[model samples]
Target: MTDVLARRVQASPDATALVGVGGAEWTYRELDEHVERVAGRLAALGIAGEHLGCLLETRPATAVLVHAAARLGCVLVPLNTRLTPTELDSHVERAELAALVCGADTADTAVELSVDVPTASVDDTEHTEITVLDSVSPAEFAPASRDADDPAVMLATSGTTGEPKLVVLTTENLRSSAVASAFRLGITPDDRWLDPLAVYHMGGLAPIVRSALYGTTVVIPGEFDARATLNALERFDCTGISLVPTMLRRLLAAGSLADSLRFVLLGGAPASEELIERCEKRGVPVHPTYGMTETASQVATARPGEAFAHTGTVGRPLLDTDLSVLGGDGKSVDIGETGELVVSGPTVFAGYYGDPDATARAFSERGFHTGDVGHRDAGGRLWVTGRRDEMISTGGELVAPGEIARVLRSHPAIDDAGVVGLPDPDWGERVGALVVGDVTDAETVRNYCRERLAGFKLPRTIAFADELPRTASGTVARRVVRERLLDNGD
Candidate 1:
């Protein structure tokens, strides 16, 4: 792994390696030197092809460390910066991280975790010790090469589903994801990608892998600032950018993006057709994609409109990935029938780290048993339904709030909608919606949805607001909404 990847850097020393937040830049030559130095540090601390943990911001240094770790054959565990100190500590202990590194911003919290490992402050580390941005031959000490089967990332649960569980992914898993993404949205040498999504999440971390593999320039925003991302697009003359549906809607609604861009990858959360159409109408090349942390990044994406158009479809699977809709009996469902979307591919994660029971539960011998419910059309395009656990049962009827939200979005007056299940004595659970836009238009919007949605599926109640609750990964927090609605006695 280190030999091949490091040679690539050495072969193109003069090439611009990367550019990121806080006014940082690195050419291939400089990046090679930096990686070697950092690898030296890791080796000096006896951290080899073992687990090395990190809590850092999105910056040039973070990218350098990733490359360095790969060279050192060390398993990289990126701790969520947003997690509490206790949460961070638990992950470190779970990964058995013998050495940890943190940026100046997160060092205190890392310390609070009481990690027995040697910890270093990356941000405050003296830059003069070796070289800041200078060309040097790659270090002589090369770590053992890791095949596609070797673990590259060890991700833990976010506690959204009880306690966090570890998800270990191999190099092949990440490479396959990067490869699939590049195929979906044709990677170009001249293309510069902007990723403002959180680094701790798969949504954000995937970009680093994608760019490194492709030798493409990725312009990373320090954080997810809508305006800052907009500014960078103009400033860097960036060509391609990845965004969640929430960010794309915000950017489009902001109406400040330039039209010079080629492709804007929209994923991380399901989006209304209205949002996708708006992006297309704005002359912004929009490709709606679908992916999860378990799948690396993207599994499918709408192909440049060369493919047939369908409402709410995430498009067909890219090369080398197989997808099927399976019924409750673990058999394939008809094309139009809804079932659990099962995926088996090189990109699938190895197993849940340290949790054999969870690992067994998450993956079948055939493929990953994704709890995500979806259906595949005759043309092979995948359309995601709501999660099985999130499905609402009302009066002996099964209702998916995502279906209602999609219908509500068709209303011209409705900006955004998030549907949930609310307690109802008569119907066990009634459908409710939290919408963004004028509450006065709720009646007209309800009428609009009535045209397409069945009576049992139409929301019985709607709470209008300026925005809906969102998670770091860009998904609307349905459980959070349930809690809020319960607290409000809605």
Candidate 2:
């Protein structure tokens, strides 16, 4: 892949590249300069072809370094600031990070990782002087004696599987994914995106990489609050935004978003059909997508158009991408038949970083097994069923809790929902429900289900809570909720 920073700056050096929520806007020219300066500093520090843990907020310096690392062939290991010190330490050790670059706000967390591997504070960066990169070009940084297969980034996984794992990202994989996302979302120079996602995830990385690729302005959030995000839409004159289902649901329910919006790319989790319809009626210009860290960002997306009909279904695979469904018995399932969603393409990661066991488990000679269960429709739209590990077997029948949750959440009363199979004496396992809302206790919810679903589908027990458990990435940790319900008295 071509050097992203070099290419974009060469094409549109005058365009605005980065904008912080608090202050500071760096143009493409300025961004390129800072990247060279920092990489020069890193070369002085003797950090090359190695991992460096970065614990900074969304800022121009952090972004510049991501490219600088690519220029030097150094692997960037971005540590999530939200993670506890213990979690942070685990990642630092795992990535074998040689240094830490932190934003002032997250300096304490960075210190926890280490006091030794020199920490550079982004708050110390001065936006007063624009360092012109006139003489030094990114083209001067020739490719070292390394293949494209080498790791450029080491992004930590959400740990939904077992422990939080580090994903080795190659320049080619990230490059392909960003190009694919532009086509998937119809990104353009005029399309200014208000991004509220955490920089640790691919959702956040895609925009930064895209900014360097497309020369578009991406407004970063100082902090994430639904109301603030809504306010910024008009304040920043943002054309589009990326948000998970929960974030969008809160924004829509709060009724606080500014008037002008082109498309709200809602993904990270499949949203309720009601949520999509509400946006449609209100002219929110909603576009639901399907992606994960493994795929870089989005593999399939449903843009707002008449030709695109399915709402819940994640649209067709992007250009030069491939997807298939493996049935429960391990064969290609027919359209409409549920199976594991397997993705194989240029954008797909080669394997999990430093974990051969995980790499082996995730893929075979066939393709990269996503562990997500989904099936294609007549229109070739993929409707995600649930995760393979999330499947609950009650008696002899396999039950996908996501199916039950989708049906239950459709009711106006239910705000948030999760379904799990609980161990039972006679049936071996019985369905369980965890909901966040006012209406319906265990019996009432069970009776409500009886009206719409079979007796077996009804939750034997219903639990009410202020909120469902969520991973750092904002996906509902269904397994965590199940364990919580089973272990703690509810």
Candidate 1 CA-lDDT value? 0.75
Q: What residue runs in model 2 are displaced by over 4 Å at the alpha carbon?
A: 114-116, 124-147, 256-260, 305-309, 487-490
TM-score of 1: 0.91
Clashes (N, CA, C under 3 Å) per candidate: 1, 0
Worst 10 residues of 1 by lDDT: 127-136
**Colliding pairs, model 1:** 166-353
Error of 1 at 368 (Å): 0.5
Per-residue lDDT over 361-478 for candidate 1, one digit per residue giving the tens place of the 0 to 100 score = 8877569887778888777888888877778999999887778888877777787887889989999999888877755555676687788988888777767777788654346777
**Which digits, one per residue and each the tens of the lDDT, describe model 2 over residues 79-129?**
788888777777787777777767657776665654345666556433222
- For candidate 2, the lDDT comes to 0.75
